[model samples]
Target: MSAQLDRESSENLLSDSRFFFEKIWLNVSLYLAFKIRSVNAPFWVEDTMASSLKPL
Candidate 1:
C-alpha cells in the first residue's frame, strides 16, 4: 500500500514538473516574440513564429 502511494506521488510530481517547464517555455517564447516585434522584425518572421507557437 505504501509502495503504491509512492508510485502515484512520483507520477504526479513528474506531470507537475512537465507542466511547469511548458509554462516557462511558453512565457519565454512570448517574450522573444514581443522583442522581435518591438525591433521591427519582418512580417513573415513574426508570422512564422506566431504560427509555430500556436500549436504548443
Candidate 2:
C-alpha cells in the first residue's frame, strides 16, 4: 500500500514537471511571435501605404 502510494506520488511529480515545462515553452513561443509581429508591423504599414499610392 505504501509502495503504491509512493509510485503514484512520483508519477504525479513527473507529470507536473512536464506540464510546467510545456507551459514555459508555450509562453516563450507566444512572446517571441508577438515580438516578431510588432517588429514587422511598421514595415507592413509602409508597404500598404506605398501600394495605395501607386497609380491604378
Candidate 3:
C-alpha cells in the first residue's frame, strides 16, 4: 500500500510539472510572436506603401 501511494504521488508530481512547463512554453511563444510582429510592422507598412505608390 505504501509503495502504491508513492507511485501515485510521483505521477501527480510529474503531471503538475508538465502542465507548468506547457503553460510557460505557451506564454513564451506568444511573447516572441508578438515581439516579432511589432518589430516587423513598420517595415510591412512601408513595403505596402511603396508598392502602392510605384508606377506601373
TM-score of each model, paired residue for residue: 0.87, 0.66, 0.69
Best prediction by lDDT:
1
Question: Which candidate order results from sorting by TM-score in descending order?
Answer: 1, 3, 2
Model 1 lDDT, residue 34, Cα: 87
Decide which is better by TM-score, 1 or 3: 1
Residue 16 error, candidate 1, Å:
0.3
Q: In model 2, what lDDT does residue 15 have?
A: 100
Clashing pairs in 3: none
lDDT tens digits by residue: candidate 1, 2-56:
9999999999999999999999998999999889989999999999988988887
> How well does candidate 1 match the true structure in TM-score terms?
0.87
Candidate 3 lDDT tens digits, 1-56: 99999999999999999999988976776666566566766777656645643642
Q: lDDT for each of the candidates?
A: 0.93, 0.73, 0.73
Model 2 gets an lDDT of: 0.73
